[model samples]
Target chain A: MATAAYRDIAIHLGVDAGSELPAQLGYAAALAAGCEAHLCGLFNRPCLPMIRHYIPPEVIERHKAECERAAVKARQLFDAAAQAEGIATEWYDMPGSALETVLVQARASDLLLLSGVVPGDKTARDYDRETLADEVVLALGRPILLLPGAPKPGLPKTILIGWNGSREAARAVHDAMPLLQRATQVTILCVDPEGQRGLPGAELARHLSRQDVAAELLVHAGRDRDAGSILLQTAQDRKADLLVMGAYGHGRIRETVLGGATAYMLGKMELPVLFSH
Target chain B: MSYRDIVVHLTLDPRNAARIQLAIGMARRFGARVSGLYTVPPPNVPYYMGEYIPTELIQKQMDEAQTASVSAHTEFMATCASAGIEHRWLSSELAPVEALRLTVRASDIAIVGQPDPNPADPASVPYGTDVLPHELALQAGRPVLAVPHSGSVTEIGRRILVAWNGKREATRALHDAMPLLRSAESVHLVTVGPERKGRTLLAEITEHMQRHGLRLETAIVDPAGQKVGMALMAEAQARQADMVVMGAFGHSRLREMVFGGVTETILSSMSLPVLLSN
Candidate 1:
């Protein structure tokens, strides 16, 4: 619960003037609302490249004007959402890659809100929706809440932690603790866990007790089913609202495969998954 | 970090109460508003068979759906009222999965019970989706907390087994699980390897855990020609790790295929809870 309290939150607003902009803005508003936080809408205006010697000034100026117009529009949108939510808000219009912009801005921010980059949809500052997660998460060194392309406004209530027993998973749980503690219910779901070391659920339950985050372990003897599918299946079966799990649990190459859990879940997740990797 | 709106997909299953109670507890914890959503299916009558169904049978189908809807709403309201959480109720004539999917908004998280594939005591309007959670997680664009059909869930994030890979996902999973580890009764960190740069990697992780104050000892398992996933499961079983934290495989498409085999192996053969982050 203290996660968003008294912090600087940055939201990435891309320039493509597409649908993703609102979702990012909306989520930022929701996160900053009533949290006593400064919500900055970091708008990546697609201005002309700094190489003015190669291009004519008139053309560059035209692009600059267009980009600035978009930035104004984006700021207006962000301001409206923030005002509606009664949160303190600011806007920054910068020209450059959205990914690079976020990486720089997030260094001073406690949290970053980003919209899922839709493949082929031209976003502001040439933001690549598909690769944003990997590029930003790896370099930002901050927590980024990725909103599904069309996100609805609300914090996750019930949560499913994809407990795979990886250092990555551990980090996710650590960063997500504040949010996990605030949830009404959380589940530790294991799909065909490689539990040669211990009984899977018992120890985790005891550990959660210390945090007052009562949790139960559910093991799926996955038979001819992928872990990602089973995880989402079990989550839906339980009617969970949120998924908390570590990202990239397998060899890096597997993520390229469609059957891989990380790839599958990221591409086809029906829920708001808080992935940290 | 607080849940403002929480939605529960109410089914006609008997275990609905358990899921509801869990959601109620979550709402109370974060001071969130609860929304009870139910998707009542039409009766599987002679209509699907393309047979001339009797009027009485058709009437019965409608009646059954109505009754199930009313009952689910009542229960949801009662639970929210008792828990003293703000609440709302929404239902649709659509398929159960579809209803739950539409209910998901960026700011809202949904709680739904898995469709009972084989309901020992099926409700008047029975439904099942062994794949609902998966579908929802993909389509809802929100987080869906899935409780098992058989277990009674109270909380999560305790007694965790962290599968360390010294990779991006592994590092992410560890940090994500930090809050849980900080409050855990015990924490176990394990790395499966064949001694390739082992000592340095192990030491690095050890130092990281020490910095974070995680007390569990780390186990570097030598697969001994066994698959890394198998080795991890064996270690998890021995440790009774209720939860396993590891990174999901989403690095390179080519590597995805090669790595998919191992991650796929764990996904298919898991025997305990594993937290996968990507």
Candidate 2:
């Protein structure tokens, strides 16, 4: 998911321009330095109703020029960022609806970085970025990094992981490998430890040890403590800057029946979280 | 934080009155406000030759029903006032999904009921039928505490299971659950794997927990020839864990269900309530 944020949506779409570009570039650079970064840029020609309608030729020309200008500026910013990041970059420009373009790109990208659409933006006529982001999360079935303002400065030093033995957690670990490798200290806290095994915990510690990361594993065994509350406490105790984990584990069915830790954490945690599904 | 200002979402089903009363008692314990929500299907429209008939009267009736619904809801809220719990009524024109999203955003936590049995197949049962909790978890980005529709709210969180893995997700979950852990009676750290690396990870986890002033015990499961999920389930059941907290396990959408080993296993097999953080 982080990869897509840096490569496709942020870099290619040039949504990182203005205040957001520098931090986005920095994150991309950090990633490239640590791992093999895949850079994908998406170009979407929005099927604007105004453009599709049989309007006067003059009006069509005017709208075309405006869009072209925006495109050119975005291109310049992206090129500069990509050049500085020193990563291989690819661009996908398709003629379709904006939503389709995003979905297609998101399907391929690791992380999706989306620029929130202002409710009353004059330039974009119909698209609602927030709703679109949510839809993309549901449709493309990937995690999304919604950059409300500029990206947070610096790579995360302290990372709080909401661990459950679910596949989402495993995917989150893989997704966070690059960052975890660079973090100063990684803490793995088990909220309900009454019967948790020591082997898997040791394996994870061993993995981090090989990566040369200073890691700690902690178990919080308590009765009646839900996973979400335990995770929040651990994050607070460690002063973690970023939390990384999987997205929703159970679907509509499992969630409705058993409840989900991810849902609880999202609602409670205030820190920045990197989620991958 | 003080437990005052609780927001409860109650179903309007008459049979659920007992459940509503139980929820109100919980709210009173926390000194919170209660909100009753009823989810109804959007009014239907008849189709004409090409376009749907615009039934103005039907629209008016729908509007009036909504108003009456809110009024009835307000009466329920008044009951809260008598009990010293603040209350309010809310009606939305949006669908249940959107309305629930809005409710989660507006409140701290949402309380919802469990699903009912399917009428067509009486033997078949439903679990969490309301989409609100999961949607709120995913989209509203809030923590939701779900109560059984029939049971009473007991002491919140007594025996918690931290599905420990040395993964980023597990670590985050542990941290997220610290507040409750500090007050827990006993915490048992369980790891399912070989003992070699397990010892070191156990030491690290033990040290971390010690700092938090939580007494910890460690358990190691070999899983041997069995899959990780089966082993974990056996261990959890053996311990009689009320809740199992673990990191969500999956990848891309398609690969998540088909290729994912641990997630599929847990989703299909878990007998106990599992807390999954993705």
Q: TM-score for each prediction?
A: 0.46, 0.39
lDDT of 1: 0.61
After aligning candidate 2 to the native by TM-score, how far in Å is the CA of B257 from where it should be? Answer: 3.1
C-alpha positional error of residue A12 in candidate 2 after TM-score superposition, expressed in Å: 30
Candidate 1 chain A TM-score vs. reference chain A: 0.80
TM-score of chain A of each: 0.80, 0.62
- Give lDDT tens digits, candidate 2, residues B67-115: 6566557656666677676566656556555665444433334554433
Off by over 4 Å in 1: A1-6, A34-36, A47-53, A118-127, A193-197, A223-225, A249-270, B1-278
Q: Indicate the worst ten consecutive residues by lDDT in candidate 2 chain A.
A: A1-10
Provide the lDDT at B127 for model 1. 54
Candidate 1 residue A49 C-alpha distance from true site, Å: 5.5
